[model samples]
Target: MRILLIEDDPRLNEALCCALRQEGYEVDACLNGQEGLYYMETGTADLVLLDRMLPGLSGEELLQTRRKAGDTTPVLMLTAMGTLADRVTGLDLGADDYLVKPFAMEELMARIRSLSRRGGGFHVDSGELAWGDLTLAELSCQLRGPGGECTLSRRECGLLCALLRHPRQTLGRSQLLLSVWGPDTEVEDGNLDNYIFFLRKRLKSLNSRAAIQTVRGVGYRLTMQSEDSL
Candidate 1:
C-alpha cells in the first residue's frame, strides 16, 4: 500500500517513514502541510498520516480542504492534543481515525491495516483495485487479467493504480508524474512514457480489452478495446 506521512517533527517523520517502509509499504514523507496538501490532492495515496499541527497549513485545514474538494483518501490525524473535543473535531473535519502523540507503533500499524481494508473516501472494497477485466492486488503487487497474471514492480504498480483510479478520464502528464513519482522527485517525462508503453504491452499480453489510449498533447486514458478492431 502507498501511504503519505505529513508531520513536522523531523525525528518522528523519519522514524515513521522507516517503519512503514520496513512493513513493505511505499511511503512519502513531508515536513510541512503545504507539500502534504499537494500530495493528498493528487489522489494517489491509499492512506494519509496527517499531523494536526504543521507548518504552512495546519492538518485541520488540509483535511478540510481535501474534504471540500471531494478527495476521499483516508486520513488519520496525529496530534498531542488528546482530548474529547479534539478527537471529535478531527473526525468532524473528515479524519478517518485519530492517534494521540506518543502512541504505540503497534496500534498505529493496526489502524493502518484497518483503514486500508475499509478503503478511503472512494470506498474501495477491501484492498483490490479494478478496472475492466483487470484487478491490481494492492498487497501482493500483482496484476490479474483474463489472459493471466503477472507481478508488478513497485513503480509500475503505483503508475497503474493512479490510472485505474481515474479510468476513463484523461490524466495530464504533470498530474501523473506528481501522483506516481511525487512532486519533489526529478524524473524525465520519457520515464512515464516508458511505463505506459510497458503497461500497454502487459494488457495486450493478458488479452484484455482494456487499452491505454494516448490523448495527443494531453496525456492518456484507460478504455476498452473494441471487439471489432483487430
Candidate 2:
C-alpha cells in the first residue's frame, strides 16, 4: 500500500517512514501540510497520516480542502490533542480515523491495516476489484484466480486495474498508456505491449479463462473465453 506521512517533527517523521517501509508499504514523507496536500492531489496514495499542527496549512485546513475537492482517500489524523472536542472536530472534517501522538507503533500499524481493508472513501463498499472469478486486492497487489494467488508488480497492477475498471470494453492505446503510465510520460508503444504480454501469461498461469484480446487497430479488451475456445 502507498501511504503519505505528513508530520512536522523531523524525528517522528523519519521514524514513522522507516517503520512503515519496513512493514512493506511505500511511503512518502513530508514535513508540512502543503507538501501533503500536493501529494494528496495526485490521487496516488491509498492512505494519508496527517499531523494536526503544520507549517504552511494546518491539518484541519488540509483535510477540509481535500474533502471539499472530493478527494476520498482514507485519512488518519495524528495529533497531540486527545480531547473529545478535538476528535469530534477532526471526524466532522472528514477524517476516517484519529490517533494521538506518543502512540505505540503496533497500534498505528493495526489501524492502517484496518483502514486499508475498509478501503478508501471511493471504494468503501468493495475493497477488492473483481471480474468473473478473478479478484484483485489493490492494497496488497495480490491477484487471486482459479489456480491460486500471485503478487503483481506496480505496473502490472495498474494495467489490470485500468482494464478491470472497464471490463469487456476496448480501451484505446492512448487511454491505457496514459492510465498505466502518467500523462507526461514518454514511453514507447512496445513497453505497453510487453506489459500486455506479461498479463496474458499471468492469466494463463492462474488458470484464468479471462483473456486480453487485442483489437486490430484499437487497443485491447478483457473478456472471459469459453472452455471450448480455450
What would the per-residue lDDT of candidate 1 be over residues 13-77, giving only the tens digit for each residue? 87777656644588989999999988887878989999999988999999999999988888899
Candidate 2, residues 193-224, lDDT tens digits: the string is 99999999999999999999999799999999
The lDDT values for all models are 0.82, 0.83
- Model 1 lDDT on a 0 to 1 scale: 0.82
Query: Worst ten-residue run, lDDT, model 2?
Result: 119-128
Q: Clash number for model 1?
A: 1
Give stretches of model 2 more than 4 Å off: 121-230
Quote the positional error of residue 166 for candidate 1 in Å. 1.4
